[model samples]
Target: MRRRAVVAAAAVLTGGVAVLLGVAVPQAQAAEVSYATRCIPPSGIGLPPVDGTTKVEITAPAAAKVGDTVDVVWTFTQAASRNPDIIDLPADSVQPSGTLKAAGAQSADIAMRGPRQNPPVPKGGAMVLSAMKGSLKLTTAGQVMLTPDAYVVNALSTDTSCAPTQQVQPAATITVTAGSGSSSGGTGEPSHTGTPSHTPTKTTSPSPPASTSTSPSPSGGSGGQTDFTGKVVNVPYTCQSPIGQKRATSPVQINARKNGGSYDLTVQFKKSVMDSPIDIPANSVKPAMQVVLGGADKGSVAVEGPKNAAPIKQGAPIEIPDLTGVYKPGATGEATLSPGVLTIDALGTRTTCTPDSSTVSLTLDTTEQAGGASGATGGSGSSSSTAGGASTSGGLAETGAGDHATLKALGLVAGTAVLLGAAVFTYLPGRRRTR
Candidate 1:
């Protein structure tokens, strides 16, 4: 009898331990896959389409039940080809978001967003994209296959959209079953990320009333225009010139006319001395300005002026013509306009000038249209053509081996581009000219 009781006690203890371990640990599933990815950068930065490989690792629960919320995570084990223009990418500068295609029992797209995290990368190194995290609710019980899809990487205010060059295979498979009990924080709705469901409904009713009240104002008559001129401000700029990095202050005058549906803007820059290392040919220098809109509106307008009429000597003062662009107000309020990046294309070589201080040059009160349509869409404006050679405009410039054959002939590579991007900021005496 004593021996039998001891054996029973040992069996009970072993069963209890097994039950405790089952409750504490959950089964996890993971898969690793490689994708041939191609990225098209934002226009005007003069970079062609870039091709590279992206290795992704996906992690999720191996098995889930109906109404259970499952957590999913994706890590970019390897990023795309390195961009030479991005010499220094600060930590937490990159934000990654992507979509996952779910098939089998549920047909939906699971969107994932990751927190910002990255170690300090040295110059000439590829950027480390952040990992993405998302979740999904199992509304039905069946096996679901999760496949990786296209993604976007927004780094340093530049957005690079990447897609797979070929058909993508499923990365991981999830087995789902009917829930034995209530699901852990699960709603009976389909799983979707990003925007809420009620957002579209809210916009339908409120826009008409908002447009009617704001369109008619005393300052701006119906179908009439208002003009604001002679607004002058000094803007300091740091430029990467052919000679070297140079700093100068130029007087910028802004004129604004609020048309019924849009605003016409004129930006004039004063004469400044630019000592070039090489002679710039006649009609070689094409300059463009990014008119940044703030306050009631947020976006940029690209304005281009005519090229130089005469050749610029090695050491000579450069006279830039007036730049003009159209601004369509997307919102109703006082909009402030400031001078942003100034890109000068001289002799097939591109020089970028970034303003140290963006002082507000003009402000105009705007209203929405009567039809409930916003005046203009928000974002960077259309790119203007370069004069001497093909160059990129606005944001970070992208250079690839396939598109830059001429640059390669001139002995310009990723390293040379890195030096050009690392422009030091300094202040110079303000030069003024009247229009």
Candidate 2:
């Protein structure tokens, strides 16, 4: 009886311990898989150079296993060029494996235009708004997917183009492989790496609007996502002669990532530029405040030298001159330029160019003949009758002589002889005796 009691008590105690152990194991596993990601601006990193006029950050994994969650964070340094009325920062989540799981915005601070010291932000301080967070549970997963989200930014007192509101979003679906240990942050500038935080000491005066004009709808991704154009400096084009006839349309687009803000853009043109100057104004765009293009020579469209060369920013239109009369055939023109420089060759003479501002204007002349000129005259005047007669006779003789060379030659001689005989016998001094 004593042995039975002892055995029963021990079994009960073992069962309790087993239950506790099972719960503890699952809790530990969940903690490792679940992580909160944050997007700290350069300011958060305590770096003076952490500000991106516009910035996008990834702070978490999209598709996590059960008990796994991803944290994504985004940052906006300044206002973007398009949709000035709003500050757009949109994001989405997907599950590639396991389950799509869940997602949310977590927390967001709106940086609105402010006083010179604090500087008014685009949307101002964080306001109760939609898209603060999102929850998506994927039952099973083969391909994890994420979509874009648009955030509204109200107008602050400091902004000149301030409107009621604006929208922002990302460019594409950022993805990572299962168990790939992906960090949840953006691939932007360097981080502060645990530096002491310090806000800007002195605020720079707000620059004037580049332009007040609006433009045609700009192209971009779904969530304020303009097409992101790659570095396009070395593309070749035909240059006209007398230094003024090379034009190029940027085939690449500036894509605004779902989370939109200001961007530091650098364009490099070829060096052989010798034509009239180029013009990229800031008055033909919308929200973008500034667009600075570097790397070119001293030349301007409708103006003088390189120093006089103005910048192209948001709300500004690029004014390109008519290149038809400028680029003549058989001439050489050169334009050393960087990107964002538009040019058109009237003569269709494509030439290679470099990135030297000293050579921004070039002329390319046609080496081939011009139109409306006769071949014998070397593209000059009409052919004379004698020349025409000679050409016709030469061509006819060459063509006919191949088939009836002897017969044709004999017939010509016979005709000449008969004409001469008739002239002499009837009209010359040895006339007919009967008359």
Candidate 3:
């Protein structure tokens, strides 16, 4: 009886400890942070600020223990700006102990257009510059996991051009009060709570897996999906003039898929600008304007003249140079399992006098499925459609490889955690008896 009692007690204690630790082990230790920044502007700084309003929103983790560092990031957008240029903000520095919920760092950049573009230059549209800005604060309980050495914040553009840039003063410490870590009955500010009561904010907003709606079933491969019937239109531009025109010829085809099952789909596209030198001759003025149009995702147009040059009267002729021969051409699209919609926009610039290309826009009709095999397995499938008074169909849509790989990895991580948890609960008590 005593032996049984001893075993029982041991089992209960072991289970209790395991459960507590298990809860703690996965109870994400993170830091919650928030901040707001504004540009001190004189309106024109020679570098020509992005021709419109800009805004940024940052949501850090809620809290961390003593030594576990969490990642911090900033997401910025050019709210209603015409010129999809860059905006600069302060970087994060080493926080004084106790000043931060976690000891990681902070960072950011001009948002890049997409994964396809490396050293991702800002697509002229708002995009996440850096996946992670800097290191984070964390608990020193077991192994002290420190944050990265440095974070990359961005620099502000001058009124004249984006080439010559200026860096802003970065902030080092994250402010936290004593009783603020918890989501409720707490100050809502993040703080270090030694016990396992903190939840780490997901590093970098949880961007949905870049899935497509073109596939038949949610499980099929990228190629076995339907292609949208549409022509690619090029936005025209002109150097040194405000008047421009657009061509309805040389249309490109669009292909896509829907994740999950929904009707509203979002679109994304890449944008690039031409590097040209302006020749408005100092003091001489022409009503030069920048116009961005198309789609429900993001669009804007701005007209700015040289400082001291005569202001461009509304409805004035804005010359736009033709870009008939530029830009790569192809029918690109994908299929998604998650279902829903996503709209992506990109930006580029023209150095001298030229028109920026109209970003490729894809409206993923998330509600339709062409065949029997739902592209759910990430396998192959097929799609059928009617284009130009004829039957059109497609196969083998490659879900952007980078996107596919990332989603697969995330699934593996989650599965491993579940297995580990089941083992701990199922085997620990039996082993305690033998001990």
Candidate 4:
């Protein structure tokens, strides 16, 4: 009897130590809930509202202490709905972002971002969205209920805001308690913080070997044509968008080859500078670059590339294809080339990016051909002129306080949907609330 008693005492002490060390904690079971949702299209677009069912499975920790940050994951299964228009949505284009309403111990809404859909969405086909993940820090100690809230789907640059039409059941619930004197071993930061937390990395592309050749000049004389290869330049750019100003470094590869009277220029972006916030339709994005010229030339030249052949999904890298243009030497000698401004046009919206500094990428030694062209012209069928000449044909979209206000309103709607879902689930028997 004494030996049994001693064993029991040892077991109790071991369990206590495990609790203090945050070991042997019970895992929270996932809970599934379904709710009716109504999505309203942007006003003045003359599109009717959409109604469907949304099923969500949420997983979270069963208990947490104050100041402890816990992970929350939500997987959504959207009801089948036909597309309203004939458009091609590229793979990973549909992105879902919304809020999770928290009640009881915490009243703040938690924002969530889901992964992009994998399959392409064809015209009049069913839409598929992916799973969402978020995190929250326990503040007040109590039972907190998390419910699905309003969400938004950005497809082909259009915002379709959605909410639950009926009462929503809570997807999960988390029990919060006072923090222990020791650390909880939790990450201090939340996963989703409204803005992206990615850092841009510098990248370079390999260059080709330099070569020299001769071509017949416009004046019937032999002109020396040289090819400058393997030039990589990194330019810092600031881009203005609906969200805010985003800064990144774009690595550019430049190659110049003298062809008779003019120099053939090719510029390629080694790395993408920004991510697309919404799905971009095929052939919707047109990219252009302004190349600064020196030495033999004094002004900048405009180069244009073809429209994107495939659809660009939301959150994916926005890539600009190779830009080609022709530059005619004005005075001869050695000419210098550098990257300047970059412009992107999506649908009707224009995004202009200005480089902080122009780094010289290529230089070519040449003799001016008689009766050669004077300014720069696009090689790929794009109309362009010098810096002091006619501007590119495109109007900038209006953006300001209105865009910010719209985003806030959408967030509130998402929060409300979450709260309603939680309240409905509380009344159902055998259904536990989740956060």
Give lDDT tens digits, candidate 1, residues 17-115: 989777434578789889888876644433456667778888888888877778888888887655343344445545677787777777668887776
The CA lDDT at 216 in model 2 is 15
Candidate 2 residue-wise lDDT, 1-55, digit = tens: 9999999999888888998776322211111111111111111111111111222
For TM-score, the strongest prediction is 1
Ranking by TM-score: 1, 4, 3, 2
TM-scores for the candidates: 0.44, 0.16, 0.21, 0.42
Per-residue error (Å), model 2, residue 90: 8.9
Candidate 4: tens digits of C-alpha lDDT, residues 195-232 = 22333212222232333232223222234435656367
Model 3 regions lying over 4 Å from their true place: 1-23, 29-36, 40-128, 136-435
Q: Which has the higher TM-score value, candidate number 2 or candidate number 4?
A: 4
Candidate 3 residue-wise lDDT at 101: 22
Stretches of candidate 4 exceeding 4 Å from the true structure: 1-24, 79-82, 181-435
Cα displacement (angstroms), candidate 2, residue 24, comes to 35
